[model samples]
Structures are given as C-alpha cells and as structure tokens.
Target: MTAGSVEVVLRRAGAPDALAAADVWLRSFAAALPTVVSPRSGDDVRQYFRDVVVPFRETWVADAGGGGGIVGVMVLRDDELSRLHELSQLYLDPDWRGRGIGDRFVRLAKERGPEGLDLWTFQVNKPAHRFYERHGFVAVEYTDGSGNEEREPDVRYVWRP
Candidate 1:
C-alpha cells in the first residue's frame, strides 16, 4: 500500500479483536526472536491473550488498525515505579514494520497523558532498541528473561513525558 493510503486507527481493543491481536503478537515476536524461543502455537497465543492481555483491556491495544487487517497491537500497564507506564507489548506485523505505525502507537500512548513510559527489550534486539531510542526511550536497567529464560539479557528502557 502507498504511504498515505494506509488507514490506521487507534482505539481500545474489544473481545472480538483479542484472538487476532494475540495472533499478531505471537507471529511478530516469533519472527523477531526466532533464536530465543520456540514459535507459539495458536492455543498458547490465545491463552496469552486471555491471561495477560484480555484481562487488561483498558491500557492495551491503543491502536488496532491497518490496511489489510489489524497490523499492530500495543499492551500497556501502569508501572509501580511512580507514574510510569509500562509498555508490555508492541507488535506490528512483519509486513507493516518501518511504516511508522509503531511510532504512531507510541505517540498515542504518550498522548494518553502518562507521566512516563517504560519497556523491556532483549539485548539482541538491536532494531527494537533503536526504535525505542528513536522515540526518546533511554536504557535504565538490564536483566535476564526475554522469554528465553536460559540466555539473552533483557534491557529496560524508559521515557519521561
């Protein structure tokens, strides 16, 4: 699709979009972290949606629109770190990467008026690190998890608004 032709909308996610959003998340993350973990099955993905995402619809899926279908999804939660918003998940379909959709979602999250924003990324995810940095996020801490649980260090980044 042409640059201006992409019609992306930002809104709260509902029940109907939950499964699809999970699919997007699974596919996106699997592609982005193939070496770290095994690909997620549909059932696992669905459970993840039901458990981690569906229960918290308020701050999740701030943007859920694109050309062919919903190409992006973001999951956020209030941080315990004082007015900080934790961006738990931000996934764009592989085909939709570099289209500014992720950036727009970040902007939308900021527009929602949180005091600060934070997210975690795998150390090997250089592209994602650059993406977060480009959007004004700075590294604050590093730990281990990254869904691998065996290897790879996860770095946390934060942005204050």
Candidate 2:
C-alpha cells in the first residue's frame, strides 16, 4: 500500500463508543439536514443517543485503521415480520465520505444482516438516494413526511438478495 493510503475498519459499537458515535451522527445529520433540522448542541445530541438509540438499536462504528479514530456509524433494528432488518440510521463523517467508507459499511451491513433490509431517507437527500441505489437498494415507497421527525417528504428503500 502507498504511504498515503487510508485503512478503514468497521466494528460493532461498544458501550465506550456511544458518545463518539453520537457526535459523528450529529455532525453528519447537521451536514445532511441543515435546513430541516433545528440547531442542537453536541451535548444534547449526545444525551439523546445515549438515552434513546443506544438502548434500543443494534449499532456499529467504523474506525480509521492505524488509530485514525471513528469515521462512521450504523444502526439497525430487527423487523418483526421476518428476518428482514430495518436500517435505523447510517452516517459517515462528512470529511470521510467519497473515499469508499460508506460502500464498505453498506457491504458489511448486507453480510451481517438478513437477506432483506429496509431503509428510509428524506426526499431532499438526493445524494443518499443515489448512494443507496448504488448499493442495489430500490425505492419501494414514498410518504408525505407524516411518519418522520422532519415532517419532510421521504422514501423507503429495500434491498433483497
């Protein structure tokens, strides 16, 4: 490998990583939903994830190999209907994107998750739509923002092996 090469590693999120994961989540969300989400302090976001998401969701964190620190996070929830999984959230540090980390993350999710998976993204997130599609997920439904926090139009995507 070249001296300038970046090594990325993905692993399950641990208790000690919840805070850093939340911080990454906040930074990604702020960048992706700047107009839709209201301003939130890092502490508030930290508390919300520690109190809410960490308790309920299965999570993963991506590390920059060679002690480069966390650069991404993913959260999944089991679907009661079957073995299918629901992707609750996935975010990459804005600075770390476009370098194949997101692709590697998605590929890992597909390997660990069941044959089917569902995910949602705001309609305004064209980049997200493209990203998911590039990984073979297809839009299966659309809603008028009533079911989500942003109250913004959103779409549901599904991936099936």
Top candidate, metric TM-score: 2
Candidate 1, position 87, lDDT: 83
TM-score of each: 0.84, 0.88
Residues 1-161, model 1: lDDT tens digits: 23367666766777777887887787788889777664556798788787768666443453434445667788877777666777878988887788787888899777764688888888888999999999999999888765554357899898986
lDDT of 2 by residue, 38-128 (tens): 4457888788778777766888888775645778999888888756888878999888878777887788778877588888899999999
What global local distance difference test value does model 2 have? 0.82
TM-score of 1: 0.84
Model 1 clash pairs are none
- Please give me the total number of clashing residue pairs in predicted model 1: 0
Best of the candidates, lDDT: 2
> TM-score for model 2?
0.88
